[model samples]
Target: MSAARGPDVYVGLMSGTSTDGISAAAARFLPDGDVLGVELLGFVQQPYDASQRARLLAAMESGSARDYCMLGADLGGWLADAAAALLAESGVARADVRAVCSHGQTLWHEPGHSTWQAGESAVIAERLGVDVVSDFRVRDVAAGGQGAPLVPIADALLFAAPEHWRALQNLGGIGNVTVVPPSRGAVDPTAGVRAFDTGPGVAVIDAVARRVRPQLPYDVDGQLARAGTPVAAVVDALLAEPYFAAPPPKSTGRELFSAAYTARLIDDCRAARPTATDEDLVATAVSLTARSVADAYRRFLPEPVREVLLSGGGARNPVLVESIARELAARADAPAVRAFDAVFFDGEAKEAVAFALLGFLHVERRPGNVPGATGARGPRVLGKLTPAG
Candidate 1:
C-alpha cells in the first residue's frame, strides 16, 4: 500500500487499564528514513463520569454478553468525543487528520490466549469522519506472544535517551516498563528493548482508598500512604506471588488483581497486624508496586538502566514516586528516577501519543509491535482500519 497521502496529523485515543478516563492526543509525524519523529499538537483528557465508570468496572469484573456488546459501542462514542475535543483544542481541522488511532478500553486481557479491547472502530470512524485503527493486541496474542506492553515500539523509536539505556515505566492501573537503548548512533532502535507488566500500579492502592473512604476515588496526593507506614510483611507476602518471578513475555490484568483480590489483601494485612490502619493498608499496596518494579529490574532487565522515566496516573502520586526511587536506591547501579514530563511531554499523554504513532504505522503498512518487547514471533502490523464513509 502507498503511504497515506494527507497532512501528517493524527489523533490517538487511549483508555488504559486504570479506566480513569480517555486521553486524546493530536500529533504530527515527520518520517526520517526509517525513523519517525513526532510533535505533540494538543492533548485532552476526558474523564468518565461516575455512572460510566461504574458500568465499565462492572463489565471488567463480570458483565454479560449484552453488557460487553453495548459497552463497546458506548466506549467508541466516548473515544470519538475525546478525539473531537482534542482536535478542537489543537485547532486542527478534521479533514487534515490522516487517521484516529484508539487503544480502546481493554476489558479482558489474558495474555497468549485471548485479548479483547472494547470500542468499535466503526463508531469512531463514523463519529470522527476519519479513518480509525483499533484493536492492536489481537495480532500479537495470535502469534503466541503476550499481547501487552505494546507502547515499547514507540519508546524505542521516539523516547529513547540520548546516550544510555532508559526505562519507560508506566504507572497506569498496572505497572509496565519498557527499557529502550539510546537513540543515538546507527544502532538498531528496537534491538535491545524489553518490556512487561511489573504488577499492580495504583489499582490496589486506589481500591483501598475507596474502601477506606467511599467518596474517595483515589488516595489523592498520596497523603494517606505518606501518613502511614507500610506493612512490610504484607508487602513481602504479596510480592511472593509467582507472577513477579515469571520471566518476561508475560502480562496480567484484573484477572489476577481484582476487587476480590484487594479484599483478600486487606484481610491479609489485618491478619498480619490486627491494628493495621486503612492508611497502612494503602501504604502496603504502594510498597508492593514499588518493590515489584525494582524486583523486575533486577531479575529481568538485560542491560543496566541509566535512568527510569515514569508516566501515567501513578506518576502523579508523590509517595508512589518516592517509594519507587527509594526501592531502586538500594541497588548499586541504581538509575535516576523522574517523571516523564520532566524530560518530555505530559506523562498522562504518553500512551495516547503512542497509539497515534501506531496508527501512523498502520496507515503506512509498517510493523508496529517490537518483537523484543512483546515477545511476538515477529513484527506485525497491528490494528484493523475502519474508513470513514
Candidate 2:
C-alpha cells in the first residue's frame, strides 16, 4: 500500500456504545512520530438529539438495510458537526486540518469475521472539506482477529512506564484492558502490551439503572449503588456468563447485553429475592463489572501487572471505582488503581484521541492494529480513507 502524506493536524470523532454524544478531539503529532508527545489542540462534545439517539438504537436492535444505509450518512453529518464544533472552538480553518478521523458509531462487532461501524466517511469528508479515515475495525477483523481493544497500541505508546507494569483499562460501554509491561529498557514497549475485553462495563449497569430510574440516563456517580447492598447471588449469576470465560483478543458491546436482556435479568433477580430494590440491582451490576475485570486478570494477564490505570466514563463513578479497588485488593498481586486523566491524558477523551493517532498513522502508512491485542495475522495499516473532493 502507498503511503499518504502525513497531516500536521487532524480531528478524531468518536461515539462509543453509549450513543450519548460525539467526543471530538483535535490532535497534532510531533515530527518524529512520537505519540507520547502529542499536542491536544481542542475538545468538544456534540450531543445527539433524543430522536436521533433513539433511531440509532432502534437501527441496532431491529432495522432494515435501508435504515442502516441511511442512518450512516445521518450519523456522519452529526459526527461532522462535532468536528466542526471542535475546529470552531479552536479557530482552526478547514483547510488547515489534515483529516477527520472517526471511529463512528459501532452498530455490530462480530469478531474474526465482521464488525460494522455506522457513519459515512464520504459524507463527513464532503461536508467538512477534509480527508477522512474511518471503518477502523474492519481491516483487523479481516486479518482473523477480534479487531478490538485497538487503543492498546496508543496506550502503550503514550503511557509505558519504565519500572511499573501498567494496565491501561478503559471502562466505556464495555471494559477493555491493555496490560503494558514495564519498558525493561526496550525502545518498543508495545511488544509487552496484552489487551482484551474484560466484559460489560456500563452497558448492563446502565440498562438496569435506566429501568429503575427512568428519569436519569444512568446511575449518577453510582450513588444509588453506593447506598444499597449487592446481592451475591445476582453478582455470581452474571459473572458465570460465557463471555467472562472466553480468552483474550475478544470484544463485546450492546448486542450481548441488550435492554431486553437486562430486563430479563431484573425480572429473574426480583423473582428470586422477592424484595429487591432498584439500588440493589444497580449495586449488583456494579459488582458484576468489578468481578469480571478481576476474573479476566486472574485468567489471562501474561505478566505480573502492578498498576491498573483506568479511562472512560466508568472512571467517574465512585461506586464502580471502589468496587474494582476492593476486588483487586483481595488478590495477592494487588495493583494500584489510578485514573488515566490523573496521570497521562483525559479519560473521557482517550478513545477520541486514539482515533486521532490512528488517523495520523493511517496517512503515514504505519500499521495500527496490535497483534498481541487484536490477534490479527500481523501488523496492518487500518482504515479506509475518504478524500475531500
Candidate 3:
C-alpha cells in the first residue's frame, strides 16, 4: 500500500482496561477539503470468555515476561478474528481495508514513565494480510507526555461541538476526559483541548461487584448501585487521594486503580459504615467515579463546557450517568451530560473509531498526538507499521 494512495477503509480494535473484550469498528473516511468525514460501516464487540478475562486480569496484576510473550501472540490472533468479524458484518472486503489499527490491550500504563500495549502487529498483519498499526502510545510517552487520552485529536476533528466546548468523557476501566473547543472556533481548534484520567471509572465498581457476588461480572446496568445508597464518607475519603488533586495531561490505569486498590476501597467503605451492605459498597464505587469526574473538570478544565458526551461501557449504566449529572449540576453552569451515541454514533464504538482515525493519520503522514492534551513536547505521528506478508 503506497502512502500516496491514501486508503480510506480501515479497522480499529480496542481492548480497554476493563479487560472485558475487544471492540472493533470498520469505517470509511472521506476527505473533504480540510475536514475528514467518517462513515461507520459497522461495529462489533467480541467479549473475552471467562478464561480469557481471567488470564488478562491476572496478566495485568502479576504476569511474568513469558506470560506476556505468549499473551501478546494469542491476543493478536483474537484481535484479528474481531477485525474479520467486523468486516463480515460491515460487508467490507479484507482487500479493501487499507490498514488495521489496534490499540492492543494495555497491560501496564504509567504516564510519563513507560507504557506497554500487547498484541503482535506482525501476527495481525500475517493473519489479516494488511498493513498493521500498533503501539500508538509509546511515541507520545517518549516525547515526555502522559501517552494517554490520545483521543482528543479525534474528538476535535470528528466530535467537536458546533459552537461551544465539549467534554468527551470515556468510562472504560479507567475514566478519562477530553475537553475540546468547538470545530468552528475562531482560534486553533485543538489549542484548547485538554485531557487527563479522572481517577476510577467502573474498575472499582466492577471489582467490588465481582467480589461481593462471585457470579457477577459487573454491576449490570448499575442495578446493585441503584439498590443501595452511596456511603458519603467513603466517597469523600477516596476523593481526597492525591490523584484527584493532581492536574491534567496525566494518565492512569489498572496500575493505580488495581484490584488491590479496590480491595482497600471496599474495606474503607465497610469501616465508614459497619452496617454497609454489598450494594452500598457498589454504590460508593459509582459515586467515586461520578465525583472524581466532576472534580477534575473544576480543577483542570480551562474553559466552561457546554456539553459532556459520555462514552464507553460506563455510559450504558443509568445510575452512573445520573450520578455524574447530579455531581455536575452542583456547578451553576453545569454542562449537559448525555450519551455519545445520542449525539453521534454508538458510544461503545467511539474509542475504536478514534483509533481508526489515528491509524488514518499515520497512513497520511499526519501527526496524531495533541501537545496540549498529552503534554508532549510537540506533535508526533504515532504507531509502528508492519506490512502484510
Candidate 4:
C-alpha cells in the first residue's frame, strides 16, 4: 500500500443500522492518527419515503442485485444532499473539505466472506464535488477478518483510559460493546485496551417493534417495553440464538436477525398466547438486547469492568439502559458500569465523529483497526479515497 498525504479537513458521514438519518461530522488530523479537532458540525435525517424504505428492506431480506444498484444511486444522492445541507448550515464550502468518509448504509455484513454497504463513492463525489473514502469494510474482510467491529480501533485510541477498564457499548440496531481494560491490573489500575461487539443491540427490538406495531417506527425510548413485564418464554427463545453462543471473532447484521427471524419469534409468542399485546412483545425484545450484552460480558470478557460507556441511538432508551445496568450488577465480581460521561453531548452525532477520526487515520496512512477487536490478522489501512474529479 502507498502512504497518503494528510488532508486538512475531512468529513465523515454515517448512516447506522437504525436507518434513521445521515449524521455528518468534521475532523482535522495530526500525523499520529489522533483527531486534532472533531465537531458534529451539522445533521439531517433524510427519511426514506414508504416506497424507498420498503424497497431497501426487501433488498436486505432478499439478495436482489438490481435493488442494490438502484438503492446505491438513490442513497448516494441522499448523501450528497446531506453533505451539501451540512456545509450550507455551517457556512463551510464544498471546496473546503479535503475528503468525505462515508460509512454508508450497511445492507449486509458477513464476517470472513463478504459484506456490502451501497452508496456509490463516485456518485457521492460527482454530486457533492468532493473526494470520498468509502467501502471501509471490504479490505478488512479480504484480510480474513470479521470486519464488523471496526470502531473499536477508534475507541482504543481516542477513548481508552490509562487506569480504568472501560467497555464502550453501542446499542444501535445491533448491540456491540468494546471492552477497553484498565491500563494495568484491576487493582493495580493499569492495563491496555481491547474491544469487540457484544452482539444484538437494537436489532431485535426494532424488528419486533416493526412487526408488533406497524403503526410505530420504534418503541420510542422503550416506552412500550416499560409498560409491560419481560416474557420468560420469549427471553429463553432469544437466548438460544446461535450468535449468542458463538465465540469472539464473529460479526452479524440484518442477515442474521431479519424480519424472518423476528416473525418466527412473534409466531412463537403468539402460539404460546394468542392475545399478547404489542407492549408484551416490545418488552421481550428489550430484554433480548440487554440479556445478550450482559451474557457476552459474563461469558467471554469477564474482566472487572469499571465503566460501560454507551453510544448509538439505543442509549437514549431508559428501559434498555436500566436493564443493562441491572444485568451487570448481578455478576458476583463485576465492577461499576455506567453510561458514557459525555452521553448526551451529541447522541445523534457520535458515530459520525468516530468515522471522522477513522478518515483522519486513513488520510495519515495509519492502521485504524484493532486486531483483538475486529479479529483481523493485523492492523491495516481502511477506506478507499476517490479524488474530486
Off by over 4 Å in 3: 1-7, 185-187
User: What are the per-residue Cα lDDT tens digits for candidate 1 across 208-249?
Assistant: 989997888899999999988888998888888999999997
lDDT of 3 by residue, 122-202 (tens): 999999899999899999999999899899888877888777889999999999998887676335657778888898888
Cα lDDT of model 2 by residue, 1-389, tens digit: 99775447879899988777899998887743433567888888787777998988898888987888889989989998999889999887777799899999988888777999999998898888899999999999999988897898788776677788888888998999988877656566578677899988888888888889988888998988998778888778778788889877788888787887687778777877888888988888888888888889888985778888888889999989988999988878898998988886678888998999899889989999889899999999999999898
Q: Write the per-residue lDDT of candidate 4 for residues 257-313, one digit (tens) a residue.
A: 787778877777777767777787788788878888889988888666777787777
Alpha-carbon shift of residue 145 in model 2 (angstroms): 0.9
- Model 1 pairs whose backbones collide: none
Model 2 weakest lDDT span, ten residues long: 29-38
RMSD of each: 2.3, 3.1, 2.2, 4.2
CA lDDT, every prediction? 0.90, 0.85, 0.90, 0.75
CA lDDT of 199 in candidate 4? Answer: 66
TM-score of 4: 0.90
Error of 4 at 282 (Å): 0.6
What is the number of backbone collisions in each predicted candidate, taken in the order shown? 0, 0, 0, 10
TM-score of each: 0.97, 0.95, 0.97, 0.90
Give lDDT: candidate 4, residue 22. Answer: 77
